[model samples]
Target: MITRHLTDISSKGFKVHEISGAVDTLHNHNRRDYYKIVLVTGDMILTYGDQTIEINGTILFFANPRVPHTVVHRSKEKKGYACLFTEAFIAGRERAEILQSSPLFRTDANPVIPVNSEQAAFLGSLYREMLSVHRSDYDYRNQLLRSCVELIIHEALKIQPSPNGLQQKNAATRITHLFMELLERQFPVESTGDPLRLRTAQDFAGALSVHVNYLNRAVKGFTGKPTSVHIAERIAAEAKALLQHSNWSIADIAYGLGFEYPTYFNNYFKRVTGATPKSFRKRKV
Candidate 1:
């Protein structure tokens, strides 16, 4: 497929494009702030998460911000339309969270829907309308395009409507820095009075304003370990440093590290270090 024309997603939050030019190799993760829908005919290989999928013929595709994906063109003869939009594009919906759990955009779900000729024609016509609406001067163009986007999304799933940040070199790198900064902010475990405010992957993810899974992908992609592992290791390292360098009691250490009880801390430290905290501390003493 050949392609041309892309509406600026950065400024307006959404745009519909006619699939009229050579299908460019697309890595969806780079555009980490948006979601995408495509209805196209082509022979292509799609790299979604860690899976590689190759498809020939007509198919509809959905991509969300949480997963990293790439589409490679395998054949020249392709036709289709693609819609791109930011999450803000749908912010006005009452329960936008519904879209967050849609199987179509889930990391585990196959994002492809085989389009029969009739379905293709119908979806294609919607795309055409969207492209026009996207380029129009109508005051309600965005609203209309949003409705069209919702329509295509539902058209693909045959379902009803639902309600569904930072700067760095790239998304993963930026996310990694954010994750690390957030991870370190609760450090030193200086006092049990202020336990770690954020401890789990979910905690950090919530603090960073992203899905835990998305944060994991970015952290693991760049750091070669899951977010939880990073958090665990950081805590473990802190535990060791405290045991060796600080005069704090084991119970105090435990509480400072966010453990409610010394026994829990002992179990955790032993599991991570294969040595009980008391034993390690004695040896250090």
Candidate 2:
């Protein structure tokens, strides 16, 4: 299995990473450590192990980091900015709470969210400003980056669409809460290299000590999707992240995501994403 390279920064918090190059292949990522905000300025394909999202022009949101995924640019050339931050960067648990509570943090059913031109411009400008401040040797770089992150989220909320449809009180209280909490605790891999250990409905069901069928029923009754569907969706979300954010090869990605054979992972990924992993990564490149 392939593991992503972790970059360390001072306690003050890191700046940001903005790379301009060939569309890179995605490695499997089944862990969660950092928060990512992406703004793509060109044609690109985003792949989560079993899902593929195409972006022509706009901003996308990926809050959870526990899934394994990757990204590919369809055109030969693409431009984008990605901002990565940790919970500490948010100052304290209080501030991080805002991020977790916000609807924007919802990465399960929908990971990549589209923004209007104006909203995109605002986010892009904020990220660009952070990148600029990051490059300069300043006394308060951490403070600046922190402020920029807050600003970016603020703008995101301003443009975020309001949640629609009737709300289900029971689902909101019992099943939904448990599902989200369980889902979050299993990111960035807790035990071994096995993806199953980190991202599976069965593992969650076992932890909860409920039959997989019961768990599935609860999740389905609430979210309209089966338990396996939710798990696969989250896994796919991570796949898209590694594909876009890292440079690991497809085989490495497969291994990292816990596939005993790359071929098995490849077929599974294509089935879910509607494109071959190589072709998906190639589009990004």
Candidate 3:
């Protein structure tokens, strides 16, 4: 398959590599003790598990250490910066809260936030400061790293989503927030081989330790869609992404997605996409 490449550096429990130029390769980088926060200018495609988001002039977060992903530069020339830090670099529990409470730990949204001119300046300054400490022979590198990250989060919180979009969130909306967290955690994994990985409400209910009927009721009440439909939609979305972007064949895609047979996958893809996987991939090509 034509996958992006990943460059991993985890020596000293954490490391950072600054990147520039078009994203061409498909690969992954893994670190046992670190998470990655990327601030980029220009444009690129980021594939995190099953979701691939188009990003430009944005700050994005990747929280899970187990999931494999890659960033591909779409242009002949691209520029960006990335920092990988271990939890140890964060030091105190308060710093950990910054990551957990923020949308960085959540996977539901595409999670790409645009940077305003002012925010961009702030981020650039923070990154420069962090780089300075990283390169310097200073004795307080850890303290400087922690402080720079704090500044980064402060700047990120200043960003406001578009007014015309999702309403402003409040703590009063607790159930929905919890529901979104649960949904995001499960949505990307719904497909086992690809024909619809999560085929039943009970499957999710079991995972969440709730009654199947209650799960169905909550999902339907909140989203106006039944649990099964939501699961199907998520699987279909992932199917389309694999078809469009990867070089895997239709049968291989079906198997990768969890379909038992190519025929079943073809039928399901046609049902949702109004085109077979082959046709859809061809069109994208």
Candidate 4:
């Protein structure tokens, strides 16, 4: 099964489907490169990260692109709705930050949240409204849909507490967490033209408003790797994904990954993976 990217959806950048309608096509175990929200009314099991969550009755779940998860439909008659959208679709919207900061989207946070029947009905209706707008040709449908998405996020926030609300004992751990979140927010590479903006440890440190040396120490102390190493590894991972999934040429891929020239990217890829991008793609094929 392939990871679903934002471009896989409609040109409008959003789509909603009944869970039962899409279950057969959904991957058994896979990751997605867009945000997802599912409102369900039946029993099922979800393998999210390292934990297995069993849901009975109504539940609302939010998924971030960085987390890999799988859904196991236990009941023959499951009823729910799921919607997917790219970050760009909700960019500049007020609730965008909620998606990033909320417990529902945190990697370590428990994303599966149980809800009462009344709450479930409210959320299910929101999804139904989104589906309706998705099918219409209204000129302002996208704006309305964005509002719907914001409403869903706000509703979920009211139910689930923010995981970050707890105080961390160590400053290094908190800094590392913030750094990782910033790094992940830039990912999935929506377009070959949208090259990665932050490619260095200094770039991240500056964005985080911390000294470069301090950033290095914090990341290294927490993750046992230098900050630059983490940046390079993430970039390399994205490079491999593009090489395997997209039709972009090596030169284009190089530029899209923030390399000054194709040669630099080739050397970096070889250093990290022991295979040039071209060879890697060929082997995958």
- Cα lDDT tens digits, model 1, 123-214, are 88888898888778999988888777766766765632232233222546656765786587678787878888787899877655568888
TM-score of candidate 2 to 2 decimals: 0.54
Which structure is stronger by lDDT: 2 or 3?
A: 2
TM-score of each: 0.58, 0.54, 0.51, 0.60
Q: Once model 2 is optimally superposed onto the true structure by TM-score, how far is the C-alpha of residue 73 displaced, in angstroms?
A: 2.8
Alpha-carbon lDDT of model 4: 0.75
Measured by TM-score, the strongest candidate is 4
The digit string of per-residue lDDT tens for model 3 on 1-285 reads: 111112323445445556675465543554434566777776667775555678766554544453446767655655556677665556477676665544444323234567877776777777777777777889988777777777766556557354333432221122233444444554443333433334556765553334577566666766788877776677688778877776677777787666788999899889876888878888785
Cα-based lDDT for every prediction: 0.74, 0.63, 0.60, 0.75
Q: Look at candidate 4 and give me any clashing residue pairs.
A: none
lDDT of 2 by residue, 44-123 (tens): 67775335778786765564554445766566666667776665666455456556544334333345667877777777
Clashes of 3: 17
> Deviation in angstroms for 167 in model 3?
8.2
Compose the digit string of candidate 4's lDDT tens values, residues 1-285: 223434446465777777653344233544454678888776678876545778778888877665567877776666788888776777674664666555444444557778887888898889889889878899999899888887887788788754453432244565687688779878888776788889999998755546688789978988899998899899999999989998889998899888989999999999988999989999776
State each candidate's clash count. 12, 35, 17, 0
Residue 3 CA displacement from its true place in model 4, Å: 13
Judge candidate 2 against the unseen true structure and give its global Cα lDDT, from 0 to 1: 0.63
Model 4 TM-score, all chains together: 0.60
